[model samples]
Target chain A: MTQLPVRTDRKLGLVIDLDTCVGCHACVISCKGWNTENYGAPLSDQDAYGADPSGTFLNRVHSFEIRPDEGAAQLVHFPKSCLHCEDAPCVTVCPTGASYKRREDGIVLVNEDHCIGCGLCAWACPYGARELDRAAGVMKKCTLCIDRIYNENLLEQDRVPACVRTCPAGARHFGDLGDPDSAVSQLVAERGGIDLMPEQGTRPVNKYLPPRPRDRIGADSPALTAVAETASGFLAWLDRTLDRLPGGGLARMDAPAKEENS
Target chain B: MNPAPSVIIFTTLSGAGFGLLVWLGLGLPGVTGLTAFGFFAIAYLLAVGGLLASTFHLGRPERAIRAFTQWRTSWLSREGWTSVIALILMAGYGAGLVFLGTRWTALGLAGAAMSVAVVFTTSMIYAQLRTVPRWNMALTPVMFLTLSLTGGALLAGQMAAAKALLLLSGIVQIAYWKLGDRALAGSGTTLATATGLGAPRAVRAFEPPHTGTNYLLEEFVHVVGRRHALKLRAIALTLAVVLPLVLLMLGAGHLVAALAALCHLAGVAVSRWLFFAQAEHVVGFYYGKR
Candidate 1:
């Protein structure tokens, strides 16, 4: 039996465009649908659609309204997931060798059969990409849809991952990052893509295009400030009136107060 | 870190077992040579037995042979190889002592060196894991080396009925313990640096991605209360280092000295547990849980 080499040079990865993302969360839902049906085990949800619906998900979008300075604001929706680094610490720390990086495609995969559910690989991951499947007693992560992408029957254009395929806003892209001529590479080059937490030295293959600047929302724009101030005043008045109401009004009262104070 | 019985037993039993061998090998020549030979033989078996007991902690024991493959980059592999070397050295040393008498001094010295190497390699296992801030310090190797020496010396003193040797070893042990404490304090400071945050900074969980507990929180972001940790450290230092040193200095009886060694062993075990529990991996920053 021939043993497979640990690393290959193909360098398969993802590139996300923050500029175009509307934070619709379609990628998140699609990822859950595909991984649950195809992966070793489905991501389980406890009390889902009930009081506290929660489950494992490979992709999640975080919406942050950044206030960089006075009168300057931006809503940046960051979709966080596995970066699949070149020097992946998660692979090195696994005592069982269950977590490994493929040299062929640069894909970091976990062999569920060999995993002991020790949770060591998850700890080693700086991005919090890997999650333990409690029911299976093994680790799981975004495979980048390895099973779907390589299927012989799929059309070339439709060969991308479920997240990329289902992304309604065209925020996600997948391709051979090692290929300098690839569309993803060209997009990254032209857009000046940045890696999150480059200080960690994980050498993440995933690149994020920074949020686009909105011309009308500039700090010096007097019209924008006037509109914001009016909106703030209306919200504050509504909040004060709501505070004087019954229990139903108490939850949202602080939101208007925070806006007025800011 | 959780006072997991398997790990505590592993560290304690292995430390005591190896420490006993070091003492027997070094002090046997000066004492009644025949009984010393018997002591060394018993010590070697106990050390091997302790190591064997540690294997039970592995989930896949059948695949343990594969552990040897990564010796190039793994301290764990080095430990395994060195442990085997130590066993072989001990066998040769025992043969020479039993059959060749005092002429085995050269081989015995080799065995002693091997014993020390085994302890050092074991120490490096914990020291090499950079993720655990508490264990990833120079003090780790120093602590293990000194603990072995202290345990071995005290054991030897009890066996040989040597009060002066016992007192000297006891003082050294206490000094090392203090140094270990200071090193741990410095490690804590370094941890603050690595985390890129100042001490006393209140970090609230702004927006955790998952509502359920994930592997990061379960494994790395362990939340042992600060008060409990401090109390444990104090008790461990007292019983494991201070009390033992004091008893030895006062020329305590052989039984009392032996008891002191056991107490210290328990204390060291507690300290090792806290070492893991209190360690905060930098990845906790992503979850905003640090």
Candidate 2:
């Protein structure tokens, strides 16, 4: 089971648009809530109410503040889980016949019954996707909601992953990335969705849509050039420009508040 | 990565055990029925104890038997299987050496092969970790093999062989650490590359995904203090390699050799702690550690 199959029929994955993501923990919660009771062992929480609360989670959202030189600072929210790579290091590092990638859809998973929870699989993963359940003594991870997606017990519309289904901003898209005609593939092609850490050679199934570049300031908006050359000079014009300014000057960064270059 | 005590003990102790068994199997001189009994007893106790210690690292020790299954890709699996082969062969060879005064050459050779093979695979377990660039060196296996052979020679009281192998292992260990430290320092990853911030710019974490520690933070993000690491490395080298070489140079008997072997192991243990402690996992980049 450690040896990966030469090929998989379809690569099922998720595409998350960083531009639209609201830095919400909904997807993380939904994944924990469902997987805690769904497919495998419950994701255990140690010291949930005590001083140090820690637990296993299949999904996480990392937020970063990136200050590009030309534009306003952008807050990039990254939602990460398993990439379910074709050449998964997590799968190969498993000493037990537990971690395996599905040949049908390329979903990397652990067989709780067979897992020894040695943590080698977790260590092997570059993405930190694999999480160990302390209570159950087994490794758990994003199953791509295999139980929900393929289950005949649910409606076809609700067959998508719990994270995708519960995303309020519609930032998460689930589909067959392998199929060229699939909607997710087309979205990836159009929006230039990129793989996280492609150098790792994980060939992660998930793709992240980069945040949209903010458009240059419009003509109607008062330009920084309109401000007077000196701080005292700007005090005279500040009253006039105050009405036209968005959300008042207090909420904004006044360019002319400081001394200007001679 | 945390230098779990169980793993550090397992790798070094079993490595020495197997190394000594290799010397015994290779038909070392002055190995009589009494000596053979002592060698086998020491080898099995250390090997079996180390293997048992590894089970404690597992979340479920009862299911450790399954670890012997997947040998095709998992170096850990290969280590388990190789240990079995080495132990079984040693048991058989020990029986022969004990009951009959004569040794089985073929069985001894096969047992020795398995013995060295286990240590090799054990090194591969760390060497193969692409996540830890410092560990993924060809030197890793060589280090393990040399250390095993050196320990074996020391335990068998082969003063000359132990001296030579100890020196070789010392040079190799220093070389490995030197190159490994450079490799870690020059690793290509950064917060920009990790988060796909694109265009070289300083990326800072505005807020962590969570307030409290998660499994990833606990397991993957071990930032060793630079001063502490330097001090430990000095101690490790002095104890593990330099001390052993100097002691063996005295050309003394089993008493001196035994003390040297003990010192070598202590040094190796300290070095092993640095091995795990200093390793920077790629996941650390995600946490903005590097």
Candidate 3:
């Protein structure tokens, strides 16, 4: 059914901490390596070695510079995937009933066999999480590493998503988010983890732990003893001291300003 | 958002086809037996041809039948179902008009209602989506319905009706574009919202997720220049509205009506292209295209 389950005992999801993510892309590479073969259809690359190679990837890591009004800019690496929202639009919008949200684990998935690859699911998604596998003629998306996560044969420690297991920075945490006492749920509450685009109203199961702002670093360091003691601004005292140099120290390096003024 | 030619043709073609069917259901002036056949042939050809064109863009076109199964919650499914109902009703009505020399009022009315409903469902496919804020509006369905009526009136050679609808639909199209522009400009979803980084005054992409243009970028990150759009809109308005209105005023002339229909079709095609090209999906924010 395209309609979401009324309720689920567990909402297994990921909590990504931006503060700890180094943007190394280990998780992305790991997810690609795992899902390409593990999922129902192999994720294919078109012109993989050619001049313009492109392929399907379930996960993507985007880097951005966020400029704040009152502080230095911060670079953040945002890893994105199908959030498996409680109200998964992609699932409900599918005409073929191919896209579905699981009642048991709360993972949203596409039945490749039934998928017509009409691309409606891709359009419905706000996250840009799902991609059409051109070769397989099906939509591909992060399955939350369903095969590995639920495989009885796998070791207990390996029973997690490839991205979570392979994250070097340990920035990714995965567990049942529905249980208030669960580690992931507790972490979300403690860190004030926020849902991306809460206004979108998808009610995503996944949460993102915001990076701690180092707003005062370097810019507001305690003044040096000499610099603090200066009557005028510290730069004025430094200017006078530097004027004693061989070629009027600061002037030589900043001669272009004088030339422009003249 | 790619303005895939197949879909544009599909929507415009089928819309006109269904529009013609609406007029046929209400009854046309040429009530002769073979004339009905001829008119229906054109309507079916365009409607079915457009429906087929839609399938051309699908990756697995063979599995399109599966689409009919999910009408419960999917607008696309409702579209397919309504289209089928409209097509069957119209087809039966055409057959009756051909052999029996009679119009079944109930069947014709139901078919006409379904025809309009099909177009409504089609518009809802995009209008209901929150992903593209510009497309998600009540005006979308109104625009589709208005365009369908205008096209139908033109095809049926109802020059007076066509002229009035042309003017109304033209105004609706302009209003829709104006509202769409404002909606996109003022949309709350930003790069900050996409990445869950709310602190920033402005967030810009330092690096894309990949060097290669992925499916998301290819499918959603369409950019249309404002100057070109304005020019196209002007052309669309002249051809689709102004010229059609002028030509249709040459009342009771089939040649002028046919010419007006052709011009209006060309104009609607342009507007459809702009519709897709201008849509800025929320996913575009991820690629810094929004």
Candidate 4:
């Protein structure tokens, strides 16, 4: 008779640091490269370098400029993918039981063979993590590099996911979230990490460290405020001189004026 | 939200089908000849046809038989089973009307109750989806029942006026219009509660994760303007409810009543389409699209 494995209270997940991330998009690319070659099917693109190109991607990075009223604009890059929630709504609403949570590690995954491509699970998900692969006739999502993470041949530290290992900024960390002593768990507890949409009540396991408080860039900065002011002042002076001259101020009509003379 | 053409046709067609059944059941005692039997057959055909059209919306149509198995957990399964029962009841009621005469009041009354139950069950299908805030309200069921009655009464009134049964049809049509208006306005808060993120605060989306549109955007992220929704609602109410009421009150005959029914159906189709199209799914919060 086959024996079942002993139950353990251990859940492995990711913790992302927003302050150190430079919006490099290396994680997104690495995830796609690994999953496309390793997973059930490659993320198919409708058009390559075409007007209406669309395809499925397991990860994406969003860039936003967060400007508080009192401080300078902070360019925040948010890397988004599946959070692998403890109370994942996507698994329960699935009528066919195709989408399920792994009892061993708390990783949520889809059994593509059982999925009918009905898209009901996608509708039930409040996080927008699931994507339907129209060409493959199934739903696709981030597996957190399941094939690479558990390979025994690799060294213990090298068993990290493609996204976490490839992150140049060291912003991504993966470990056992269930253990209070784990580095990721400690960072979350100390840094006051926040869920993206807590009101949705999905109870996502992944946590995001809040962006560091941005310092105000003085109006003296050469890139934006200083350059804009100088350019506008010069333009205004030229316009006033041009108005004083005969026939709209230019000696030659319809011919471009030299920058030095103007 | 994306309006799948199949769903639009299914709900609108089924509304008309069930609406026709409700009217026929109400008027069985008063009407006679080929007219009574004709109305009965038409209602049965529409009900079956609408049910069939709804099946096209399922991902696995071949496995549709499994839908009947989940009545304990799924309202969709309940609607399916109840509709079938209602059909059988209508068949028995139709046979009695043809053979046993109008004296079979008990059978007629039972058929009417079943028809009403079918409408109620169909509405509950949407009302039970807890994920969708707009569809989970009590008004959803009330709207379905009222709309069916309104549509059925209008059709009956037109048919009766054509056969010179004016007084009876007129009364039914007027009653349906009033009930429908109240139901439409009464359900506003339910929709607001579904989408409203209480107390206005600036929640800016800095970056979206993906460059391309995903399943969530394709299914639920509709960007219809506020002004457009208001204008469409006005058009729908006027064409569907107001015009029909005025025309019927003016003693319009069967042909006019038929024309009014068509206009009302078109208006109801737009209204129903907006009901699904405008519904905001809470999942958009993750993508930062809403």
Candidate 5:
């Protein structure tokens, strides 16, 4: 059925800590490597060694710069995938009944056999989570590493998702988010984790722990202020020369003029 | 948002085809035998041909039969079902008119209703997509329904209805354009909400996920030039509504009607192109394209 389950037994999802993620993309590489090898089809690359190389990826890392109202700008590495929402729009929008949310684990999966690749499910998703694999002619998405998560053959410690296991910075954490006492849920509570696009009403199982307050390190730094106060001789001359250039030190120039007039 | 030619053709032709069926089922021309057959043939050709064109963009077109199974939850599935049922009903109604020279009022009325339902479902397929705020509105369905009816009246040679509808469609088109321009901003979804980042306007996209274009960017982020869009809208409005009305008023002769239909079709085609080209998908926010 394309309709989502009324409820899931356990909301198994990932907790990504933005504070700790170093924007390394190690998880992305590992996810691609493991999924292509073990899952349904290989993530094919078009023009792999040439100009304009593009390919299907289950995970991607995007960097964004956010400036606070009164502080220096900060760079945040956003790793996005299927949120496996309580109300997964992608699942319900599938015409072939190929996209479904697992009632047991709350993970959304695509049945390659049933998918007609109309891409309607992809359109319904607010997050760019699903991609139509040109080679397989099927919709591919984050499976939450279903193959390895419960595999008896793999070692117990290796049962987690490849991305989670391969993350060097330990940025990605996976556990039963449905369980209030789970470590992932506890982490979310402690760090004030937030849902991406909560107004979209996806009710995503995955949570993002926001970055901690950053130190004062830019133009308003105490060290820079001290250095500016002690400017003298050749150093002061160089500052004045640079300040006089067009569009240079305009704020400072305006400040002195305003003071003189007042 | 790529404005795939197949999709443009599909929506335009199919909407017009279904609209024509609506009038035929209402027995406006009241033709029988060969004349009915001729009209039915054109309707079927446009509607069926357009439905086929829609499948061209699918990755697995061979598996399209599976699309009919999920009508309960999927609007696309509902559209498929409604279109098929409408075609079947219209087929029976047309057969009765052509072979038996009979007009079954109940069957014809049912077919007409279904035909209108098919167009409505089709519009809902786009309208239901909240990700594309421009299409997710009451006006989308209104525009689609009005255009379909207006095009139907023109083809059926109903001068009064066609004239009234053409004027209405023009107003609706202008209103849709004016309102759709503000839809994304009105939806209150910005980069900050999308990423849960800084103040809504303060966050900026520093880098994309990849250097080369991926499926998301290729499929969603289409940039149409402002001047070109304005020129096309002018052309569409002139040919689709204005020219057709003028030709009909001058004389609804066979030659003039045919010319009018051709012009209207070309205009609708341009309008359909703008429909896809102008739509801004919310996923574009991640790449700062929005």
Candidate 6:
């Protein structure tokens, strides 16, 4: 049962665009809301509203500061969940057959009933995707909203993962990555999506589109000089007014005032 | 990696127990009736007691029986199966020698081989984890098997084998530490690779995903101080191998052998603690903990 399928029928997964994520954490909150109420067990929190609060969150947003060789440093909001790897190490490491990857959809899930919470699956995961819920004493992870994605009760548009449905920036996209023609697959192809730690050889189903090259601001950039040189209309009048009021224009303030010097 | 006391006790005690079983199974200290009972008693106490101690860390120990089901792919499951089978085999062999006053050579040999298999399977539990580069090496099993054999020989009072194995295990232990130090770097898993942010661009964890530590951090991101680990390694080598080797060389008397066994167990426990505490899980790279 812990052995991986030769190939998943659908490879349903998320493609997160780092270029557009705003780090709002709406997806994180929505995932917590939906999974806690609907999943096998509620994601438990210890020391809630206390000095040291920690909880089991299926999805988490990590913000990183990345600096390119030539450009200004930028913050990339990295929202991570289970990647549902083709060769999911967590699945094979499970002694109880509790952790498994679905052949039908390739969604890695935990059978909460069988989980002894020895945490070997968590240890096997390089991504830190699985969290052992303190109160429930079972390993909790992103199920990719297994209930919501297939539910007939929800509206057709709402039948996606809680995180994907709730993402304000639309940074998250869900589709059949196994199909090269699928939207997520096309996104990966067009944007040159990359795998996290390909060296680990988990063969993650989900992909990340690296942040686009940022607009660089050099010391002599025209954008910088334009603002200094082209003070037009109201700005020109304000400069003249300031020139009349002070010993000289605002630029002259750097030097000794003419009146004081005299 | 958290070096949970339950796990340390489980591995160390069971390792020594199984090691002793290896020697006993080979009929190295062949005894029958009351004398066999004395040897078997210590073996069962260490092996069974260690197995029992392991259950203390489980979140739902009642469901632990289900862990025996998935042996096809899981090293942990295989470990469960192998340990149980080896213990049962050893029990049968012990009963034959103690109660029936018979050697049961075939049963003894099978149990000895199975006991070694149990130790190998146990080593693979950690050795199979690619996320922990330190444990994911061929040297890991070498370290485990040698240490187990060394401890077993020490307990069995096989003076010649104990001395040789102690020297080998000491060398293997040092080599493991030296090689394990370079494993993470050699694996080429950096903050860059972890985030899919390629090299040349400086990538740093500006803020953590959470304000407080979670299971991943608490479980995997143990940062043993370099000096502290060095100190423990020296102590481990001295106690586990050096002292026991010296004591045995001077004399393998009952008292000396007993003291050597105690020193070996303590040393192995400290070494096992370091084995876990110093294992840098690759997930720590994501949190900038590496």
**What's model 2's lDDT at A223?**
57
Model 2: residues with Cα > 4 Å off, grouped in runs: A218-262, B185-187, B224-227
Question: What Cα-based lDDT does every candidate model obtain?
Answer: 0.66, 0.86, 0.88, 0.67, 0.89, 0.91
Off by over 4 Å in 4: A1-12, A37-42, A102-105, A113-116, A144-161, A175-181, A215-262, B22-37, B55-136, B155-203, B210-212, B224-227, B282-289
If chain B of candidate 4 is superposed on the true chain B, what is its TM-score? 0.80
Candidate 5, residues B102-149: lDDT per residue as tens digits? 999889899999999989998998998888999999999999988888
Q: Model 6 segments beyond 4 Å from truth?
A: A218-262, B224-227
Which regions of candidate 3 fall more than 4 Å away from where they truly are?
A215-262, B224-227
TM-score of chain B alone in model 1: 0.78
Quote each prediction's TM-score.
0.73, 0.91, 0.91, 0.71, 0.91, 0.92
10 residues in a row with least lDDT, candidate 6 chain B: B218-227
B139-240: candidate 1 lDDT, tens digit per residue = 677777766666666565553433343444345445544554454344333322222222323222234555566545666677754348778777767766
Q: Which candidate has the top score in DockQ? A: 6
Residues A145-164, model 1: lDDT tens digits:
99889988988877788999
lDDT by residue (tens digit), candidate 6, B77-182:
9988888988899899999998988888998999999989988988999999999999999999999999999888988878889899999999999999999999
In model 6, state the lDDT of residue A241.
82
Clashing residue pairs, backbone N/CA/C < 3 A, model 4: none
The interface RMSD values of the models, given in order, are: 6.2, 1.1, 1.1, 6.8, 0.9, 0.9
Candidate of highest lDDT:
6
In lDDT terms, how accurate is model 2? 0.86
Cα error of candidate 5 at position A212, Å? 0.8
Task: Give per-residue CA lDDT, model 5, range A213-257, as digits (tens).
Answer: 887767656653223545789989987888788877664765688
Model 5 ranges with Cα > 4 A deviation: A217-262, B225-227
User: What's every prediction's RMSD, in angstroms?
Assistant: 9.6, 6.9, 7.8, 12.1, 9.1, 4.5
* Top model number, TM-score: 6
Worst 10 residues of 2 chain A by lDDT: A253-262
* TM-score between candidate 4 and the true structure: 0.71
